[model samples]
Target: MRTARRWRHYLKPLVFALCLAPALWLAAGVRWPAWVDLGANPVEKIQHTLGLWALRLLLATLAITPLRQLTGQVEWLAYRRMLGLFAFFHVAAHLLFYVVVDQQFAWPILLEDVAERPFITVGFAAFLLLLPLAATSTAAAQRRLGRRWLALHRLIYPAALLGCVHFWWQVKADIREPAAYAAVAAILLGWRLYRRRPRPAVTGAAPTPARGSSRD
Candidate 1:
């Protein structure tokens, strides 16, 4: 009991700090860009890391549901929002790097990429979907929106599917990593569908109506 109590006390802050760790390390890497050798193509490396971590965190957010189901721990839901927000933060970083470092905010290049590059187009769409979800994750928004919040959040399904497609399309030759991400996404999505599937009705005979009551 004492151990569980202590764990509950520290869990939120620990998870919060861990979520921020990647951003902090990425910032340090930027400061020591030359000192830290990411790869032959540093820009690609940085962008890949940002996008990969964002996708990974997004998967983690989805995994919480299955994890809770298996473990019967409802508290797991508490961290889903944090994971999603961190995913969004990493995605924002990914875009900022592409815009500021790669494209240099060139309007022509940005427009051309979005229009011509399927990967960039779907990635941008995924980010656009995330914008509203991240915006309305607040308790106040939940209260104000009520059931509408859940409907709005369902946008994540398409957003994540697009994110997987974007990653798969961006890969040049080696597709194993992207394939794995896609597989994870498929499993998560399938799990949700499986859980929501309608059950077969009971096979028992219909019950008799009361003498005074007529069936509606």
Candidate 2:
């Protein structure tokens, strides 16, 4: 209980650091040919960066419930909004890199690419879905919308599915990493479904006492 009570103070920083660790590592001059452009393929590097961040965010989102349950930390709910926002940030970065750098902001080329690439279409759809959820994550929006806010936010599940599909579809070889993420997502979604199932109710009928009456 004390751990639960004090969780809010530490949760945000811890989650943020965990999420940013990879990006920070890249920023700190870790120049792997896969990540850095020094004779490396820039497009692949950008894809790798964005894809890792997206998967990390998705995993983090799925982890929230399990972590909260284990820690008895209800206040961890406060971190969800920021965590979600960071996920959106990374996904948007992914999209921007593809659009501006890879496609060079050419609508004709982008349309052709999207049409030719089913994975791109799925990823684009997922990103579009995340936009509204991130936009309405504030307290003001929550208060204004009430139950409807929750209903809209439920799209996260499908968005995550679409994201996983996007990743899976895009990979040509060494699909182990994407498969691992998909497995994790399946387990998370399964856990959620299990939690939501209806429980059997106990009947109020009680057993009668023995027929022999001592008082008589």
Candidate 3:
């Protein structure tokens, strides 16, 4: 209906802004360096915030199909692309912040971190997997790749899994947050797999022998 379409149009921008809010908030920290002790370690704070949002948005992107199926509203698909793109943006930001600010683009140090730190390796791998997914997100690539697009997009599961592991492994003390994220990812992926499973074949019970008809 017209109302539904109007709401959808309105929601796109609203959701976009909502998604960007965390990044914008983090950026504001630069203006007020002493705001809540962020000045002391702004890089680490921004890095962690961006990384968390990236995982959250990736999980949001993965929820689309299940949401559509559950609600029977195909319109939800319209937002999935933007949501996924924002996820990639957050992830790219997270990684770039680490490489540029934290590591100062020092290749030797960066390579050492990737090689020696298990959590960093996992996070880097997750970022790498998201790269192709982001690149092929356009209509041109989708059409050109055809079935291959779906197959490539399936990489999201592994990427999300790696992200969860990376978060869990990186935590110095508590892991409840990462565990919660992992649970959410597992549930979402499980739902997707459940939806994809083939249904059992239905069969009649020998046709009931025609209920004692003429062929007695």
Index of the highest-TM-score prediction? 3
What overall lDDT goes with each candidate model? 0.82, 0.75, 0.85
Candidate 2, residue 196: lDDT:
61
Model 3, poorest ten-residue lDDT window? 207-216
lDDT of 2 at 108: 95
Residue by residue across 45-136, what tens digits does model 1's lDDT show?
78888998889988888887777666655566667788888988988899989999999999899999999999999999999999998999
Sort the candidates on TM-score, descending order: 3, 1, 2
- lDDT agreement of model 1 with the native: 0.82
lDDT of 2 by residue, 107-203 (tens): 9989987888899899999998989998887778877887788788878888889998999998899899889989988988887787667766658
RMSD of each: 8.0, 10.6, 9.7
Model 3, span 48-145: residue lDDT tens: 99999999999999898777677656667778889999999999999998988888899998999999999999999999999999999888888888
Shift of residue 156 alpha carbon in model 3, Å: 0.7
Clashing pairs in 1: none
Look at candidate 2 and give me any clashing residue pairs: none
Query: Best to worst by lDDT, what's the order?
Result: 3, 1, 2
Q: How many backbone clashes does candidate 3 have?
A: 0
| CA deviation > 4 Å runs, candidate 2 | 25-39, 203-216
User: Residue pairs in steric clash, candidate 3?
Assistant: none
